[model samples]
Target: MGAITIQELTKSYGETNVLKGIDLAIDDGEFLILVGPSGCGKSTLMNCIAGLEDITSGELFIGDDNVTSVNPKDRDIAMVFQSYALYPTMTVERNIRFGLEMRKYPKDEIESTVKDVAKLLQIEHLLDRKPSQLSGGQRQRVAMGRALARSPRVFLFDEPLSNLDAKLRVEMRTEIKKLHKRLGTTIVYVTHDQVEAMTLADRIAVMKDGIVQQFGTPYEIYNDPANRFVADFMGSPAMNFVECIVFEGNLIVESGNQRHEVVIPNTQAVIDSGLETVILGLRPEMITEPKPHAESGYITQMQLGVQVTEPTGPDTLAFGEWNGQEIQARLSPEVGAQAEIDGEVQIQVDTGKAVLFHPQTGARI
Candidate 1:
């Protein structure tokens, strides 16, 4: 029962407010991830949750207890920081057993716990090595083992894998996910890496400027972002935004001397907004090389003049100008190669999957 509830939480440094009235409820045994760019107050929020920083105002509940004023050690939570923070002179076994030893656990119990955690993290063979003798990934695993030795009510990880290389980061991510499944403890993880948040989180809280932009599952955040900011933030290549005008019930996209009308069915919100111009958001994958099945009513096909093509093994990315704005499309590597040599390609845009945003407010229409 490690459920956490935060209500109207605020944190400030003198006149500067780092967290502004944050409210969130994380269920018991759930993996909740707080993700945002640097300086978005995610780390501050994590600190507040861990009792390291005092909240300016608001109530915080861990499980059934109000732990707003509780000391970090008394909060029954273990934290794994970005830095391994292991003792340079101490062996891995001692580093892991240090927490249990401080609590006065029996020597046999500490040794058994260290062995079990080491096996779980696959670092059992490295137990006799010091921090200086281990690789970055190995050190990170040792840090995790140190935290895992304690059966705490909650686990806090603050960019724990940021120090590792890309390949090692991915491997460690899988290990973390497996650990979460094996031990169904509540976790509040903070990371600036979107891939980590997307892959590991049960739910992600996207933040910006000390405010939560949206809170939902990875699919919801990626497929149905609340606004342009969220839509632009989640994707790899980032979503493309094009400004266009609304006429009748269709959006008019003007490219050079050619004009194309994209009719958006069931667009009551856009019609009621009474705005002539709006922004259209589309993912690169949604625009692709034309196929026989691309002639649907909701699909719009256009010939694009190829400017550049980049082959990235799985798929090729084609870039060109649309309405004087740089637009990108994900195409089959074979088709993209042929299009690059031919100087033009036919691509289909799935307007049914397109999103509209209010240009002034950046909110979804």
Candidate 2:
């Protein structure tokens, strides 16, 4: 019953359009993450869902109710923002029960709800403490508790972990995932952190310039991107887009004056494609140190003078040049790509997962 349906939703402010033709359906108990840069209208879309902003056009339905024009208080939703907006003067107990009290719930019922939520969040020990006395993480829990007391149909979180330190952010992210599993409420979370979107979402909607670029599971978006921008934006080190010529059914990438032929899964697509040139998308993990006894079937090598090598404990990152553009290779420490190493490392590029895009349109080939 908590499902939300948005159809051709558009929001504009005078001459500027913030959300352009957004169409999305959030299923009950599904964890959905909306991610993009600062001005991509993710937050604006969240506000529209919560009934805080008036929609300029289109339809919105929560469950079976047409709540597009409903007031914020009437919509069955609870929101937690990036800023933990708890009352400074109220104790944790009061803050948790305030929403229930506003809705005229009985005193005994409110107390029971507070006890249950406090146990769920494991903040029972901190109930006597005021906002000023608690740590940032504790305050955030209290804010979430305040929302949970409402037991609404849908939950909205607008970058709730962006304010915490790195370690606390990781901890809270796990907590939120656990909370969602326990509650099984529909959630629409907005974040600029790609890591968060990948780890916590059942599905991710990547946005750009007020448009949703792609909507799919994290694995699909990462491995099988729809276009160049999605491939470039979703990865940590970022997928390297190397310009190369498509000649004779083989894509070419050159390093140190030697041209390397990269194998494509759809070789016929490249052969039939009228494009003489295209950009090859390769992740750092795909390009690695050549295996000592590695068979040479589908893998190819690129010879490059090593520029710099960095050890990040688990793996070594080697930076080098390909066709005058800087590219990174994730190398095994066993491959002797240590820091200050001077020799050229023969890095193997796996073409199984490699993707090709048109140079001009940035569309997948």
Q: Report the C-alpha lDDT of model 2 over 1-365, residue by residue, as the tens digit.
A: 89999999999999999999999988989999998888889889999999989999999999999998999999989998767789989999999998898899999999999998898667899999999999887888788789878878999999877766788678778888998898899999988787899999999988998888999999999998989989988988889888988888888876556888887888898877888988989999988877677675669876766778877878888888888777888877756454336657877888788899999888888
The CA lDDT at 95 in model 2 is 94
Tens digit per residue, CA lDDT, model 1, 1-365: 79999999999999999999899999999999988888999889988999989999999999999999999899999988766589889999999999999989899888899998898777889999999999988898899889989989999998888777888788778888988899999999988787888999999899998899998998899989999999988888778787888887678899988788876655787789889999889999988987786656778889989999999999998888888888889999999999899988999888777889998999998
On lDDT, the leading prediction is 1
TM-score of 1: 0.94
Best by TM-score: 1
Q: How many clashes does the backbone of model 2 have?
A: 0
Error of 1 at 168 (Å): 2.7
In model 1, the worst 10-residue window by lDDT is: 262-271
CA lDDT of every candidate: 0.88, 0.86
